[model samples]
Target: MEAFVSTEDEPDEVVDAELVPGDSHLPVIRHQTPLVPDADPDAWLPPEAAQDVADGIAQATRDAYELHFTQFAKWCAMEGRRHLPAAGDSVTAYVSHLTRTPREKTGKPYSPSTLDSVIAAIRTVHRDRKLPVPETKGARQVVTGYRERLALAKDAASRPNKASPAKRDVLRRAVRTLDRTTLAGRRDAALMLLGHACATRGGELVHLDIESLTPDDEGRGFTARLYRRKLKKWQDVGVFYDEDEELCPVRATYDLIDALELEGHTTGPLFLRMDRWGYLAPPMQREGKTIGDPTGRMTAEAASDIVERAMARAGQPGRWRSHSLRRGFVNSAREAGVDIVDIGRHGGWADGSKALIGYIEEADAFSDSNPLAQINEAERRKRGAHDQH
Candidate 1:
């Protein structure tokens, strides 16, 4: 059977192509021919170019790019502008719109970091299609300048839009509010503590597997092998149980596991999803799998949602995110006089991590370690000695 493949530079045209079978229901495409321009519709796309388009991006990145592209397309449709091979002027205009308008779902403006992702998505589509990227130097300047201005305005208003890291007191308050009697409540409590102790990102926490954790020598804690997505590597993370069983992550995790009846399942996702009725999702039976097999996993975004709800219930003000736990751990450790190197290693950061250094500097700024404070203390002692003399 012949299938129609949409070609670039030909909005109303489609070419007959052969479909290849895929692992799932959707058929994989071989793209029998190259994506030639309209002037040479029959000419094949260069083999190297096609290969670059195929291999340059990972599946997850492609999915994200497509999602961002769709959002841009929707905005273009509303504004009656072309989206494909998007114009520089249109992209600048879109940036303006993004800054000026709030998103419908969250009723908030997109963060500068999110805006960068959207721009990267737009560039990816253009690169795939072999088109000139719409975000030219001028367009980039306009967007970046606008972001700076927006940040300044926010600072002036004393409403700087940034996630507040979960400090020790904040974590304690949140844990105290968690109703650990219920299965979901227990799971959430464990999640909050584990997130803080391991300093794992939301994505890493969601993707944890039973096999990834090994018991410590005393069996009071577990060593977790976490996959760091940014560094594209696995890291051994140590998570110890607190003396207070009520707030101990290891105990909470074990309790949740017992409640879910996940014994003997050492290869499935550690965290499972919850149903609307407040029950943990029941394990499913696959074709060749055992009955009551737990395979469902939580998502990073779900982790954020969980944190946000917990913070609200704990009476915490200001925006809090999943990253807050990680940040909180770093700052708390630094404030407690933990060495920066040790903190970095615990957080799965590379040696001499500039990011970790930044955290340490920020934490030290308010401490007695500050140069000005040390100078003031020395001056006070000198003045006291002179008076005694």
Candidate 2:
């Protein structure tokens, strides 16, 4: 495995270094890449060097930070910042861009917290790569300055969007109307219901298995045990709905089992793809089968595409994304007066506050105000009168 590192040293010129060439035991040369005189200094590091630095990081860390760094790299490429100067202000300018760039879809800029992650990703690369990423004063002070700018941006993004609970119910209704007959349809319905009912993520849905899910006894509700990827967390989710309830994930799964006429299936996929002849095929056909792959698992992307098609046919107006299921459930749970901590439990979130921070409480929760609240208020007034007597 050979690795090439590129950098810019002076205006109108470039520098390069050769390391880890094809043969593991060969010596390499380090060349200085000069910058063009007319070129502007990059915010911190050149794209090639940044890429090399990022690639050298461990796989787990890379997965965690890749999105942030990739977005930063994209911004740099767009801005034509191809090299790092020994000044911190250059980095600050990049930070300003992150804070100021309005999101095309949302028309809002990045928040302080989000910008913080993006900057931290870049800064970590610089520090690890031993780049001179400073222009203002000290490195720490430079980061602080960037943070202040991010804070300012955060303030701008803070204004909330107000939507009625009725609107959310409308969305929920749309989700419920999806055809639950096809394998894809059934899977989509279950996924959406689990997201809305049990509060699950797409990744979590991808990970579902018979081993991870089980029933209580002869005929009760099922328990979905989810392994959280983000926080390496785990949660036990219980699902049960009344016999007459529509849009019920639990009932949907029950109906699926009965439809398949599966008296008992302890193994294999809980969800499978339907064949052209309209037969449910297990995710993996037997190895000796005429047209089945040796691998038995369905990829997550396939799962998402199924949902996408389902939503399209269902005539749902808003985007029905994988996270929508999770977000919808969280939104409903919060509005239902489920405590923040319990909400975290149901959603497999490590921290309730941070989870709830992204979720806006739906307006409809207040529609049927708690009668207990009114009773408590009345009792409090009576107690106050007694005290006065």
Candidate 3:
């Protein structure tokens, strides 16, 4: 019989054992005291299964959870409370503390959405350890009350800091600042134009592969099969040529592709990193074959920085981020009289998304619902008739 290794550090006092068909000689030991009390014996996983469970979650999500849980643990240590199996009242008090406590950098209380994420993080960590997740009913109620209080106070700080939309005028000016002859310049131009045209999130933009792009049959534009991580599916986004060659997304994309081909890369990452000297980083290779590597690919943060730098160089003010391109597309499309449903589909927004609706509503406020515009038009018409008479 082979010795069974316990998953945890505690000594395993095996009271009984059983054998299965595949590994008849190896025993599945049953400990006198289980790690999770009242848990079903059949539901327990072996030590070997830990990595498989962790692999199910995305790396980015796991990183965030680790950070959130660490913060909760530190807070618990300060308050002299257990965090692993947190008490219901202790969870509620933590929620209150988070709501009232101002962040060191921002000097404002954490947003309601952030508070919700923290509570979710705590619940997730408890579940991962096979422990009964603490009831967050009180925590939820506390968050709801915080929202109500924010509404009543009407504090500007309570509002979300939405990224400013980079409309057509700003985009046109920004692209002009780049020197087309340089490889870096061409890549930056393509990145911004393509991002705006497809309304791509920063993550989606950075992950795009060269093979995913297909030139249109009529040579009008390109159709990119972008993988939406949230939807867990590939979505097609079409970007057409603009009348102005300087601002054409299709032209910019082609220029970038041509430059990359000169560097002997026909596939792999659609965007590559470049140094200050304008030298493109070579594709990563393993066993004499190109492979996907973080070193050769642009990060989401880098994409945001590119957008901000371009906007700053163009002298366009206000807070600009990568999301500005997506938001800008929705607002510009709505203003152009494009149907809301069509705009939502192009942007890969789930039906009935509040964020998409908010952009549409903002566009309508100035055009469709402006009472002052209606009054001014009526007065202008009456004055023209009297002048003619």
Top of the candidates by lDDT: 3
Better of 2 and 3 by lDDT: 3
How many pairs collide in each candidate, listed in order? 1, 18, 0
- Measured against the true structure, the TM-scores of the candidates, in listed sequence, are 0.75, 0.57, 0.80
Superior candidate under lDDT, 1 versus 2: 1
Residues 183-233, model 2: lDDT tens digits: 445655666565566666566776676567678675567788887676666
lDDT of 1 by residue, 1-389 (tens): 00111234655534458987756865777666756446556545777776665554554666766777788877876787778778988877777778777767887766666666678878777766656788556656766776787677873322335467887789888878878887778778878788888888888888887778899998769988898876778988878878767667788887777766643444577777777666554665579775433566877777788889999988999778888888888888988899888898888888888877876787788788999999999999999999999
- Write the residue-wise lDDT of candidate 3 on 238-357 in tens digits: 888988787788899889999889988788888888777777764657999886555488877778889999999999988888888998888778778999999988889888989888
**What are the candidates' C-alpha RMSDs?**
10.9, 11.5, 9.7
- Candidate 1's C-alpha lDDT? 0.75
Backbone clash total, candidate 3:
0
Best-fitting candidate, measured by TM-score? Answer: 3
lDDT values for all models: 0.75, 0.58, 0.82
